[model samples]
Target chain A: MEFIFVLDILGVVAFSISGVLAAMRKGLDVFGILIIAFATSVGGGTLRDVLIDTDVSWLTNMTYVYVIIITTIFGIILRNKLNYLRKSLFLFDTLGIGLYTVVGVEKAISAGLPPVICVAFGTMSACFGGVIRDILCNDIPVIFHQEIYATACILGGFSYFALAYFNLPQDLIFIISGLIVIAIRISAVVFKISLPKVY
Target chain B: MEFIFVLDILGVVAFSISGVLAAMRKGLDVFGILIIAFATSVGGGTLRDVLIDTDVSWLTNMTYVYVIIITTIFGIILRNKLNYLRKSLFLFDTLGIGLYTVVGVEKAISAGLPPVICVAFGTMSACFGGVIRDILCNDIPVIFHQEIYATACILGGFSYFALAYFNLPQDLIFIISGLIVIAIRISAVVFKISLPKVY
Candidate 1:
């Protein structure tokens, strides 16, 4: 539980940094940067929660909100240093998506959604923040066409159900399923793995 | 109520046609066109419903879905004929925004949100579909910068509250406020009205 909590924070930080980077690339002002950062950090979860017809977490819980704001300010100040931290950021991003996918799947399962919908829920929760960011930045979503981004989360969703089917301990299942996503993303990036281009 | 229903269907058709134009401009295939059309038609209301934490209307109601699908087909078939119908399309679009704005505000009011947030909700419900369509087509949201588009919806929202404050009948307030949005948009376009450029 403590481990998941830490990963959740890491997910928020990773997403916030990504938002700051995208907004900066677009030359948005400080307010735009802040808005993008907030949206990116919470957009996916908020979307999933909305689909589940529940109160938005960020509206009710301010921990992630404060984290995103502080992170945005730090990212702006440290813009020059971002290049040096690329590797670390990539790792955090991978971990963030992995955790997000599992959490989304778990939420859907708890809500009694079907398996197909559960997998979709998991993938959207992990990826939709980037979708929102790219939309606001006026780009075709950067994450959508990338082979590994959605594919990794989707496979992570599959691994989750597989783990559950064998009746693995729930905690162990989550950690393992999340790790599978992280591993796939890392290995894909390291090896330059890609699916055949449809177009 | 029946008039509102007709206006709602008209809104869907207008939005679908706009989506088709956008997707066609981008040279997207038929599938892409269909997806974009559907998104444009329901994207805003779906977003509003999501924010209000309710079961999404389209998922529960098949009427809009069938309307969008049929509209997309006709939009494609009449692509060349659309040029002659530009005036009609513009009128429909204006009326669409007008009706959408009031409906959004009324929904927010029924949900018991604060007035300011309700106004924002109304504007978002009238505008975000275009935002989604543009994002998908890789353009800055076309509806956002247009002075009259959002301004009309916002003003309509204010009109709703103002009329209610004065103890107007609910139905009368809805009709009057919706007409205000339509009037604002039509006049703005006719007169070439514009907000001064920020940059």
Candidate 2:
């Protein structure tokens, strides 16, 4: 439980960083940056809670909101000193995707959802934040155009449940699943991998 | 039940018109207009349903999708002739808010939710589409900054339940509530009225 909490915080911070970078790149004001950061940090969990008929996660936990604010401030203050915001932002985004996907799967399983729905929720939780961020920034979401984003989350979710069925330790399962998502996302970005356009 | 079916179609067309106008102002291509129109027409209802643990309204009704596409095509073909796009867009937007607020309230009431939550759902259904549209267009949501936007929906919802509780005739209640919403919205825009900023 404690380990999960730590990972959740890390995920939130990573998402916030990515969101701030996206907003800053668009030259949005402080309010806009804060809004994007908050949305990316908690958007996935909020969507999951709403779908599962629960109170919103961030509303119930003010700590998440505070974390987003602090992280946004940090990013704004250090942006001038940072030499490569793009690369760092990409790394943080990948980390966020992996962490949120696993946490989403865990939450869905706890709610007694079917495996397929759990995987769907995991992918949605991992990617929908970036979708909103891109939309708000007036850009096409990179996930829709550039890489195998949601597919990585789906793959990780399948691996997670498969390992669970094999009686793997829970922590090990989470670590392995998260690593798979991160690896797939990084490889996809580096190798110019993407889904074919239906049209 | 038949009345609801008819009203649902009307509401879809009304929302789609506003969406098309907004997208046209941006000079979007056909695909972009379709996406924007679809989001504007159904985004609020989708959010409301997801929050209430119901399936998204459009995913079950292909007619809504058709209506949006048809509206987008119509808007594109007649763009140059539609000098009154701004006026017509406002009218359609107001009508949509009136109809959707009542529908949202009715759905929540049918689900046996408390009155306050029903009111909230009504306002949410009436406003979230514009919120999404603005986010996607890289503008601050009009509701967050301008006119008596969400206030009109809330008032209309109150009028609806108030009349129903007093055993008013069904048609009279619906018409009166909807007219109230339209009146408030139109008046606010014409008079350049807005809620005072809190900050």
- Which ranges in model 1 have alpha carbons more than 4 Å from their true place? A1-45, A51-53, A57-131, A140-199, B195-199
Best model per TM-score: 1
lDDT of 2 by residue, A16-50 (tens): 88889889999899999999998877777777777
- Supply the TM-score for candidate 1: 0.61
Model 1 chain B: which ten-residue window has the lowest total lDDT? B190-199
lDDT per residue as tens, model 1, A62-109: 688679989988999899898998988888889999999998998999
lDDT of 1 at B29: 99
lDDT of 2 by residue, B1-199 (tens): 7765666666666677666666656554444455567778888888888867786655434677777878777877776666666665566667778888888888888889998889899888888987887666567787888889899889888988889899999888888887888799889889999999996
Model 2: DockQ against the native? 0.10
| Regions more than 4 Å wrong, model 2 | A1-6, A60-62, A85-89, B1-45, B50-109, B112-199
DockQ of each: 0.14, 0.10
Clashing pairs in 1: none
